[model samples]
Target: MHSKELLKGTLQMIILKLLADEGKMYGYEITQKVKELSDGQMVLTEGALYPTLHKLEAEGLLITEKVSMGKRIRKYYRLTETGQSSVLKKVDEFTDFISMMSRVLQIKPAL
Candidate 1:
């Protein structure tokens, strides 16, 4: 599994991108998708995910719909237009960050 700190840093962008690609999705679905795509190396915890989802909705980045699924109502999240527009930018920013870190953390043998 990946570090919580590293995952925390990119959670919002990841969710946004996922929703952009997959349309409306419930919380459990989102978690499963992330695990599958990352080969089970990354996960979205409730402690981490719900708060961010709420925050994004509050900020107008996401909107939700409640649909009755069998015996219960499920809240499905999809990206707002603004959220879609920003996902690519966030991805580029993350790539740049990883590149910078890679350069700084390059391994070398001591003489």
Candidate 2:
């Protein structure tokens, strides 16, 4: 598993990118998807995930819908229009940052 410190900084970007691609997902589903995508290398705890999700919703970058699932009500999150645009910008910024760091560290740039 990746260190919490490393995962901490990238969590928001990771969430945004996933929402952009997946359309909408609930908290647990997001956690599972991250784990699957990273081949179990990355796992997000509810402690870390919910706060970030709430923060994004408070910032008006995300909107939620509640759906009935068997005996429970599940809250699903989707990006707002502002969020859609922001994802592209954030992804580009993160890409550039990685490229710059790779160059500085004399490592091959990430694809």
In terms of lDDT, which candidate is strongest? Answer: 2
Per-residue lDDT of model 1, residues 1-111, tens digit only:
878998888999999999989988999999999999999999788999999999999989999999998999999999999988888999999989888887799935367
Each model's backbone clash number: 0, 0
Task: Report how far residue 111 has shifted in candidate 2, in Å.
Answer: 11
lDDT of model 2, residue 3: 89
Would you list the C-alpha lDDT of every candidate in the order shown? 0.92, 0.95
Q: How big is the positional error of residue 6 in model 1, measured in Å on the Cα after superposition?
A: 0.8
Candidate 2: segments with Cα more than 4 A from true spot: 109-111
Colliding residue pairs in candidate 1: none
Query: lDDT tens string, model 2, 1-111?
Result: 778998989899999999999999999999999999999999999999999999999999999999999999999999999999999999999999988998899997458
Relative to the true structure, candidate 2 reaches a TM of 0.95
